[model samples]
Target: MARRRRPKRSNKEARRRAIYLLPNLFTTASLFSGFFAMIEAIDGNFLVASAAIFASLIFDGLDGRVARATNTTSRFGVEYDSLADLVAFGAAPAVMFYVWALRPLGRLGFLAAFLFAACGALRLARFNVQSDSAKPSKHFVGLPIPAAASMLAGTVMMWTQTSLVEPIPAWVAVAMVFVLSFLMVSNIPYLSFKSLGLARLRSFNGLVACLLLFVLVALQPYVMGFALLALYVVGGPLGARLLERGKAEKEQAEQLEHKPDHS
Candidate 1:
């Protein structure tokens, strides 16, 4: 009687089959934090819930960086991260805003929250389907979902930190939510800070500016963080306009330079 030997799995195939745990672990933790935030908000623990959103942001950033650093990037990981972001940065903030302050606004509040969530979802979908040529742009095609969510979370947190007993007015909440929602799906170009090669900053002034910015943030995080986020939100549209004007002027000058010598 002869026994047959089975073919063994090759190392390359085995590696491919094995999911990389490190980056995905960060993503899972981010997803959990987002859920925890929603639960906290539901339970009327707004402060802690806001902190959880911040924690999710940290984990979200770490996961992508870890994937790149470890050379363990996978399509599976990218899709997983996107799902986590939708929960953490889109749904979580929307829920928190609704539970914490928007509830008092009644129908308007719920609608606003829904708008934010809907826009965030659309933003994520557009990102997933974006063209390769558009992918390398130094600016985002629209306000990033995470940034919009962060602005909401940061505003709530700043209010609490400032010891404000009065809840945000219905009008204010409605306005903020709608503005943020529109920004999410807008074609306005938002600066992609990732395009800045931080590691390659060799200029002394750049180093100084970084240090100063850090000091500014450390001094009054609640005020400064919210201010910075607000600045970014407003800056995007303004920046896009400025860039457009520059381009138009450049084209006009080029056309004049090539015009026939009619004078």
Candidate 2:
């Protein structure tokens, strides 16, 4: 008697599995980059470590877009991405900063690094919860972990390029870490830029602006990267304050217009 053969999987199922794996693969690349950054940092290769973090940032950005484009997004992907982010944008940067500039402060330095990671974890958790329950908005509720990580990485690159003999002041590093941690957990609105439709822009001026930006960045990546991240870090709070002031003025004007004239 011939033995019965096991049923073979369908091509559709195989293809589906492969497609779903794509985004997770990108997430793994990001995680690997972040882990490499930590290792480089420990070995005192800070410039390499900073570059790795930025590499991780690029991978992190691509995974979400790939998932969405392929319509293969799932809860597993979301959670995996968050875990990768906590490593890439949280622990890795903390370790890099701690080793590069925070080591002199000893306990305060390490603690500040830990605080940044913890705040990043909290930020990711809050974002996940909000994404699941709230309507999708054009703004993020707090500073994105990647942006915060990029800021630190940019600082490292910029500092390395500077001609100053003195190391970054301990107080300045500590203050920067503390402020970034606070911003991560704060409620300030940060533009997500998801609604910009950059992929489908129809204007020549927009294309020229983007080309100019690329040229400028290529000319002085370290300086430009730090400057851009710094502007983004400050823009959230400044923009909010400006919007509040405008609203107040508009309300005052409306009240004045409604007032009865005494003639």
Candidate 3:
């Protein structure tokens, strides 16, 4: 008999076997959005730049969910997400704010922006190494990069709505940059969205409630964003303490439950 020939594996199958592409592609797009945001800021289009940062935030949020939903989570995906986040949430916002508002403050402005970028990188790196981290708590140990960037973006949007058309005051911009930068790497606890797990929701009402709130916010963005972001910033420490209290109560209950009856 003639020797049997083996069929060649198609490139698609080979790639599917070798790596997860969808989430990585999303991460790439997120990183690109950040870069484009910087370009827009450089061109003096602050509105478009802020919009791009928000665009990146959307993509950044999707990448992880896609990875988990598809059961394609991997170390590569995790690290890539972190790096993309640093660019999208850290470096881009800092640079955009620097050119748009902080640049007028001389060296102080430059240093403030630099500090924000550096702290973002540090925050990401620390997150990566904390292997035993409790399941995404109701809070974070510091200001999440995306939230800090969102606040900056929201502030710019608010400014655009005001009568003061001149560039933001140099001192205020400089001060804000430093404050936000410090928040990025600080030990202060901040809320994480994971406490409300979508998968475990018992009814559609939860989803409906969320959608309605989102609609309201979209209708009045400036005021809503300001209020929401302000609450988010302040809620972190409060949330953390609440979480700790909950944990302690559960532990105490468990201990009591384990005690033997004295008959």
What would the TM-scores of all predictions be? Answer: 0.91, 0.89, 0.79
- Report the alpha-carbon TM-score of model 1 versus the true structure: 0.91
Residues 96-151 of candidate 2 have per-residue lDDT tens digits of 99999999999999999999999999999999999999999988988999999999
Clash totals in order: 0, 0, 1
Model 2: which residue pairs collide? none
TM-score winner among the candidates? 1
Candidate 3 deviant stretches above 4 angstroms: 1-18, 131-136, 162-164, 198-212, 238-263
Better of 1 and 2 by TM-score: 1
**Decreasing lDDT order of the candidates:** 2, 1, 3
> Runs in model 2 with CA error above 4 Å?
1-19, 257-263
1-263: candidate 1 lDDT, tens digit per residue: 89889899887666545578999999999999999999999998888888899999999999989988998876678789889999999999999999987888888889899999999999988987783236477888899988898898899888988877688877888899999999999999998878898988899999999999999999989889999999999999899999999999999999999999976
Number of the top-ranking candidate, with lDDT as the measure: 2
Instruction: Report the candidate with higher lDDT, 2 versus 3.
Output: 2
Model 1 ranges off by over 4 Å: 1-18, 131-135
Q: Rank the candidates by TM-score, best first.
A: 1, 2, 3
